[model samples]
Target: MFKKPVNDWKTSSPLRSSDRKKLRLKIASSYSIDTAEADVLVPEGILSVKFKSYLNEPGVAYLAPDGDRDPLWFSLGKGSDAQREDALLIPTIYTLWKMPKLLPSLSTPKAVIPIISGGADLMIPGVIHCPPSLNEGQLVSICKYERVDIDGAPTPMLSVPLAVGRMAVGSDQLQDSSQEKGKAVLVLHTWKDHLWELGSKKDVPPSEPIKTEDGAEENEDNTNSKAEEEVEDKSNSEMPANLEPVLPEVKTPTYTPDEVSQLLHMSLVQAITQSLSSLPASAFPIPATIFYTNHILPNRPHFPELVLHPSSPHEPPTADSPSTDSPSPDPSSITIKTSSHKSLTAFLKHAEKSGLISTKAPQKHSTQTDMLVTAVNAAHRDVETHHSFATIGEIEAKAARKAAREEDEKKQRAAANLEIDVQELWKPHLDSVELFEAMGESISKQYTAQEVRSLLNSYFATHQLVNPHDQAYIALDQALTACVIPKPKSKKKSPAEEAPLDQAKVEFMKRDELLKKVLNSMQNWYQVKNGDMGDEVALKKGKLAPIQVVMKMRQGRKASTLITGFEPFNIVAEDLSEDLRKLCAGATSIAPIPGKPANSGMEVLVQGKQSKSVVNYLVGKGVPEKWIEVQDATKGKKK
Candidate 1:
């Protein structure tokens, strides 16, 4: 009853080119349902061929480190139009393979991919189009081919289609080129091991079979099938709430303090490997272990193995720690032992020579202050440098004038030169320039010429006798001294004060008078369609202004208590209740809130006594009693 299935299907691996050609023939035969002619795998007509410049190509991919789990190269693609901007284009199958415990579908817009350069990790946006037939644990092959005109050699001109597939077992290579047939010249050169295993019936990992040879059909199935697969995977792939992503583990380096500090400054993981090459055998090799465990591990919350040590170097020394001892008989200085010392005796000897573990007794605070004063006096020096306090020619002219005056007085003294050093005078100018630069342009604009001169003068004066540290404090003090506070002055009063207006003195427009008369005259009023006025309008007959209608309507209701559920204009004649109809019929004038459905004739009153039942009802409905205002018009008071 068992019949052999057709062996006409192509099963060539990408690594083999000769087998690929043979496989192509088989693919062509098996693809067609029609059995009339030799159905060979043939290429559809090549569309426009695009050549991507090596430096300008959108996608730039590199290889990952060897030890990384599921080592994959990362590729970044630039936007087609935006210059120098790159983004990740994550393949559906490759993303799912990289994260096998989860399912990926069209809905997943983002993915994490391995970046080969420096073993970096990249977060990329997912592609909307799902891949066909490829499943988890597969390598993604990116293939493009192009023809080359090498040394006037003419190669075979054959039509070939460009194609790429996810690998089930090993790494896949990617090639980029600029040609149609050349693009398909992806010469794969390996045998399909799966076909050989089919006959033996051994255990094989679950894999989705390739659907068809026609790429178009495969593309169509990719969308719907991925959705279904994702739904199916949801239940099976569920992990604990605390489960997190794991980062690849790396080796630690043996680092000395200088080396460790240098590596910390560099932020290079390879620095650990380099550091280990120079470390002495006695010191533990643990820079990568400590640095990564302390800083890197925390950054990767999903990677728990990164947590290695809990204690910092500043913690208490251990049992075998070196002894704490005094240094040699140096009268003036003290020294301490360095952590790098080999042994206790060695550390003590070095500390003694360096005056760290000193033999001299500690000085009292008053004695220390006296020693500092002596040091300051010894450091002072008197040296005069020439300055352009006045220009060279000006100094010469002033000297000549002084000489003539002194000769006229009949007293000839030695001629004193007033020439100042240009460099010394310009020091203040240079300092001013630095100050102006530091304050930035906006602040510099607010300074007046006098203030600028004062600042410059203070800057130069401090430098003449003091060091930079003391000069800063002097400059600050000078600025504070220069600041002036203005005193407040009393305001002058006018001779006459305007009096507040009384009711009779208040001015009224014609419309205002009409409004008062209209309200006093109205017996009943209600909203009606303007279209139904029929020339005998109520407002016209009463000689009432629109403003009066609005004012009286406001008087009939608390401004905030208008009917809210429906628009006033939408309330037709049929909506009027019997009580409202009677109220309107009894009065010749009425006023109702313009936006409410209530009838209006005389004043309507709302009263509240705060009964326990009423309070409970308001509370049940989540209403605040403070928001409800009750007014008793009869009593002329608000409650």
Candidate 2:
């Protein structure tokens, strides 16, 4: 279910001792493992996290006993309900690697492993071997047969499980192998899926070598031979034509230093002629780092053998191939250092001599020392005649992938910028309490203007207060009059100057004007709501506080920007701090705002004077400009 990266992930408090114990029992019972094993799998001090799959259905609760980074088990339910026995606890790939025998395994052909990893259900015909006692609906591990050398003899051994799923049908149904045609196992988690990406991302552990007595190896070899014979006999009749054993990977080609230099020169020519030729005149004088990374690197030719199979032998000193004894050098790492030239400066000097490019030295005041690529000599002999080793389709595909990645990143940033809408509302004062009560609402509760008008209309209908002479007016009663009229300010006066008290005025008011006066007489409040699911509308007394961004001078010339008021907007302090660190390229910290309640909110402190940057960032994140107040103490005081 976790095919794509999870977006709505939330970490909850560590599980209680009682809850942890209950979860342990549930896992043991559900997986039919020993209580002791379950204890190790899920120990005390376990933290729980909730995350939704790409489908954004009901979220799954992940238990991370080891730490937040290594979530071992996931249960399909709310975080609080994880302790239940029916939580459907599923072990992650990391957990499966630790305890390979945690579940019964079904052996499939080596060719089928990739298909299964791609999220396809294992067909009955693909199963090379199955445990006789396997039952339907039981969780199982899928494994592939690997040819491991044992005592100088090649023996097909079962590799570590690469996937986990439940059996679609029991072994009894598969007795007539030819008759079994449907899916064998319903795959759940796979090796390189999103769930696996959540962990340490370590490679699958190698299968342990079988150790035996002096003559045991021979007997074991014989048993493997007989098993292979049986598999061959069955495959001959039922196996699909396309299903074949995985072949050994071909070795990558190596090159001498001179050859490497030539390749680098050709790549540079291709980069200049094809990649940089289209740059406009305004884009001249690009930084060497950007030119190399964005243009030169992508235009370089890729070794198909090395790209397709990373584990291929890097040895065997063929005249053209790479040495097998050493690992292949990373294509991206093929810089001037690896070429005949000692450095980028020398490489660029040689290119300048060849009349293929122009370069400029760094300015004296610039922070960086790298030279700039001033212009490309597109009409030079080398640039005009260079033939690109990388195909047109490959270049186009790479460009497409880069564009897609950039678009996805933009989408992610937009998603992270949570926009909260805090609406202003009003609560009735004691003088207007009777009116709200008559309309069936608590006097202390807040209401929007529309809601207040609705309530007033209901009250007017019940009281039959609509003016008969003019439909636009409303006849005011004692309760309505008290709520819709402001009390005149009492002025201190001398005895002789005091005037006779005036009787209560206006018995009627325009409906709109009466509503306006009622709202004015009530206390001000605010209601906040965001886009996140299951969040309650937050109501508070007084006006909604704006996010405060203040730049304060610290320890002489150094300055720090402190921001507060994120709680109401549902922004996490730690997340914002991390984003600021990346955006501003400076250190950031989060601390509880001083003088405020522990739960009020957190303050994000970023190094240096970043008040303006912080304000712009919040505005980009959908916070209204008026909702952010920036104060700069570093600025000089007015004369």
Candidate 3:
């Protein structure tokens, strides 16, 4: 029995305390031979011997128990002499009963060896006294007692060297010295011979006799010839093996005239003629039809059988189709037959063209394995666009683009239909001031600079007005008048004329008067339409400008309709009389005291001034104080 190497738990480790504990437990649980018994010689004053023997046959050897069981008998050898003692011997005592290998030594001062007689228990000299500290694998000689010599010279004690074990031995009989020694020697010799045979035979083959030196050269030649014969035999044993034989640069299969004739079973001239005629005109030979029904054909049983046709000068073999009794071909089956030596080379061009076979097919492939991977995502967009996973801005842009496209398409369709008046579709609102205001807002909201220009172009084109200035003015009026932006119509001209015509128009009209006129007209139109105020005071040359129109507003007002005007100071004073009463409105009153600085009286105050005379005096840097207060009191006569 073999013992697995034990891990010494006493060694230091990097493991944690718990892990080390578990490891120690596992090591402690690991197995080693625990109970082996052997007779070992201990150096002592009196000779001590121990032997284990069986009544049935003492000459038989035994093996120690696998673990903790008793030793059992095993036949090691036979003995010849009766005078010599023999006993069953355990071989692995050296491994199993070895000391210092986890087995505690027996503590009894005197060892007891058991005895047996007639297959029953008996007592004999017990264990041989041995030193307790012997290491494993150390050999020691033990003594065994035989019957006392006639003269009482203790019959030459049996001496046998033994390896210690973990078990102890007890026997009923003593072993004879000479017989045990001879038997031990025989066993050792037999085991050695067995080991030698095993080592020599490892991977070795059957032996052959060596040739003598005198015949060495001939033998070498013969060996070479024999090797060649062996190779030839090996080649011939397999199909297609002997077909292409090469010996370095020299090859065997090349044809001579005689070989060619022999192969074709015809004269050389005839064979050559047949070979030449069979070839096609093309440098590359016409591909032969290689395809056959997958299954053997039944109509001609043996139809594809290989045969040498008499008509062929070379007697080339053909696979004859099988003949059968059936009339209609079986749908589920097909067979192929082929010649042995010649190859079938089908062009397969039609098959490739028809897609039955791939044109550049791989030698071996699988459609499922070569399948294309499909995207998990499927989304549709216009032909000119791609699907997008849009952010907020991208979504807005896409929507804008789509709207623009739709508008263009609509304009195109409208132009395609010759209309009486495309603008008729959009009736300008004659009422609703609020709607007019909204229209401007919507235009600002929707149209970018480019789009505004495009709208203007289309509007002018639809109205058949070519002067861009006039066209733009009219378009602006129409938009404001309409109260909303009506879709613009598409324009067309000869491609060459369009570019220069577009250029002639002012690209921007930042201060155009026509635009302002249009805005005013639109405002009046909207004011009437909404019924907000049909009587809005239109500023005349002498009339005061409307105050509401002049004031600033929180919301931006379009400057288009707002006209700037200049008024005389008198008119301004008349208009602002109420507001002038408030000092915050930049108005003040003054009076004159007698012989003092001038104060307000009948001093003739002009527009926004305290008094006209006072103003005149200020301009002249002098004023009469008496006149500042008294102005034409009874013509300044009675007083």
Q: Which segments of model 3 are wrong by more than 4 Å?
A: 1-477, 481-511, 518-639
**Could you give candidate 3's per-residue lDDT for residues 357-413 as a string of tens digits?**
222332355533221211111111221132122122233356669857976787566
Q: What is the C-alpha lDDT profile of model 1 across 1-639, one tens digit per residue?
A: 001222323221122344333323442333221111111111121011112323344332211211211111122334421112233222222222322322212111111111111111111111122234434334333211112234784221111111122233111111111111111111111011221122322222233221222343334344433433433333322211221111111112223433322222222222222332244545432332233323222222121112111123322322345111111111100111112442333433433353322222225753322111000011112101111121222343576697568554542221111111011011112223334443232322333334444554544464442235543322222222212111123235332321221222322223233223322322322322223334442221211111111111234552211111122222222232223334333212223545545653222211222223323332232233442333433345544
Estimate the overall C-alpha local distance difference test score of candidate 1.
0.25
* C-alpha TM-scores of all predictions: 0.14, 0.37, 0.11
- How many clashes show up in model 2? 10
Instruction: Tell me how far the alpha carbon of residue 432 in candidate 1 is from the true structure, in angstroms, after superposition.
Output: 69
lDDT of 3: 0.25
Worst 10 contiguous positions by lDDT, candidate 1? 370-379
Ranking by TM-score: 2, 1, 3
Off by over 4 Å in 1: 1-137, 141-165, 168-505, 508-639
TM-score-better candidate, 2 vs 3: 2
